[model samples]
Target: MMPSPYPLEKDLGMRYYASDSPGIGGRLRSSPEDFVVEELPLPISDPNGPYLICRLTKKNWELQQAVKEIAKHLGISHRRIAWAGTKDKNAVTTQFISIYDVTPEAVGLVRIKDILLEVVGRSQHPLSLGDLAGNRFDIVIRDCNPEELAKRVQAATEAVSAGVPNYYGLQRFGVVRPVTHIVGEEILKGNYEGAVVTYIGRTYPLETETAQRARRNFAETRDARAALADLPIQMTYERAMANHLVANPGDYAGALRVLPPKLLSLLVSAFQSYLFNCALSSRIDAGFSLTEPEVGDRLLFANGREDIVSSRNRQAALMQIRRGRCRIALFIPGSEPMASHGPMDEIMQDLMEKSGITAEDFERASRFVETKFAGTLRAISLSADVQADISGESVRLRFTLPPGHYATTVCREFMKADPYVMI
Candidate 1:
């Protein structure tokens, strides 16, 4: 196993790379255009539907913020806007969104800087997350070492083509402050107060000194009003939580509930993702091959059904994996009771025990967030048909990843640099 050199990555359970090649040292997203993402959405067809489907193209913009800007221009609540995927703010991203009760003329009239919204079609249903088939990425990495570049690219490409551990990217947690999982742990442990405190008061070194000072003051004094005075207006979500605390003292759960339901759900989901990362890494650390299953592994088929590898089906599962029929997957625990079936489940159970979490805790979280914490399966590994090109001191990668996969996971195998470089 090639352990990651970055400390932040290690903290997040992304501890190793599938490829061992000395990476072609480079940086990603030197500019917005350098990292392009085009969503492959599922078909949307309804000529006279209530929801207007618009293709949103933006450069260097956050999806939520961009949606809020569009909502402001349209004089509607941002809740009316829905998207399939949440895209990074630092890239050129084009994806579809559904705006309810809005016409194409109104959408066309509304515009923001570096943001293009076009009415593509109409849908009876509002778009939800994971509505896309996949996303195509055209990324350029700049300032790479030229010596032995081809050799390193060849090695990394081969490894990535075979498969790479499908760990969630840095963006799953806050890029500037990776405290989402920490907040989640607090939530699952039934410490709503700790969750609120962590969400509002935890400061990262990457954040500005003023932001850090504000958070520290809040942490030290537990004074929500004082924090409000120092907290930047741009810290909208944090400020909202702090304001809630000021109005209703000692209601940490209420403070958390003040956040957008989607954001609150994500805070808990991040913890599930972190556990999956750890289980994947532990599987590799136990000398198990990613694609090949042993007697106690779980197999996830393309159709979303699951089966356990057994003495009777181990060979069959191996053949199925080789033929692209299914992949090994790990479970993300939730409110529903899922009986332990295999080694993967055992790993998760151990993790839950160690973390002081249980199915009941997830039930409490589900009630608090108003989103079902029902469990799901994630592929343990992913492979992409990579196209690599080089010009002068840069390298470009073109590939498409299925919905829910991260392009940075592929890029990391090639670059193998600090996570901040990719961010």
Candidate 2:
């Protein structure tokens, strides 16, 4: 196993690379145009449906801000807008959104710079997270080592095609501060005050000097009003929490409640993602094969059916795996976790114990956040059929991943640069 060189990556439990070949060192997203994502949405249209479906294409815009602006233009509540997935602000992304009780004419009239909204169809239901079938990514890695570029790309391509650890990308945690999961850990421990403070005041060097100063002041003084005054308008969520605190005074949970429900759920889910990353890394650190299953291992099939490997079914499980029917998966624990019948379970249990979290803690978080923390299985590794093009000092990669997978995971295998380079 080849461990990553970045300390932040190690802290996130993304310790090793599946490919040991020297990476073709490069940087990703040097420009917004260099990284493009197009969602492969599932069919959700109905002729006489009440929901207006719009294909939203935006560059350098955050999804939440875009939705809020769209809501403002239509004079409607932001809650009426729904989307399949949240996209990164630094990329050129195209995805579908469902606006309830709206018309094509209204969507056409609403316009924002660098954002295009086109009426696609109507749907009987509003889009929810994971509504897409997959996503197609067109990415450029700039300023790579020119020498041995083709050879290294080939080696990495082959390795990734076989499989790479499916660790969540840096974007899952905030790229600037990476405090979402930290906030989540506090929430699961029933420390809403700690969570609110962390969300509002965690500082990172990557942040702007002004932003960092505001966060530092808040962390030191716990003066929400002052922080609100210092924080830039772009820090909408943080400002919302601060405003809530200034008014409610000591109602930390109320401060958290002011943010969008989806954002709240994502915070807790980030912690779950962190646990999965660590467990997967531990499995590799302990010399377990990512592609092989043993007695008591969980086998997850392509069709979403799951079975535990046992003395009776071990051979069948192996056969299914060889036939590309399934892969070994670890559980992402929620309020009610699925059975993980092997060392993966033991590893995750150890992590939970060390973190001082309990099942009841998740229950409390669900109630506080108003989102269900449901357990699910995730494959340990991901593979893709990649197409790479080399031209001068850069390489462009085109690939597709099923819903919920990160394109950066695939790009990191090829670039192997610092996580910040990818960011």
lDDT for 375 in candidate 2 is 77
What's the true lDDT of residue 263 in model 2?
Answer: 89
Per-residue CA lDDT of model 1 for 283-337, tens digit only, reads 8888888888988777889888888889998999999999988999988999988
Candidate 2, residue 203: Cα displacement in angstroms equals: 0.8
Q: What is the lDDT of residue 203 in candidate 1?
A: 91
lDDT of 2 by residue, 1-423 (tens): 589999999999999899888898999888999999999989876968999999999999989889999999999999999999888889999999999998788888997999999998988999999999999999999999888999999988897788899999899998878889999999998888899889988888888999989998998898999999999998999999999989999999899889898889899999999999999999998898788786877878888998888889888887888788999988878888545478788889899889998677888899988888877889998999999999988999999999889998999899888998887
- Clashes, model 1: 0
Q: For every model shown, what is its TM-score relative to the native structure?
A: 0.98, 0.98
**Following a full C-alpha superposition, what root-mean-square deviation does model 2 have from the true structure?**
1.1
Off by over 4 Å in 1: none
- Model 2: colliding residue pairs: none
**Cα lDDT, all candidates:** 0.91, 0.90
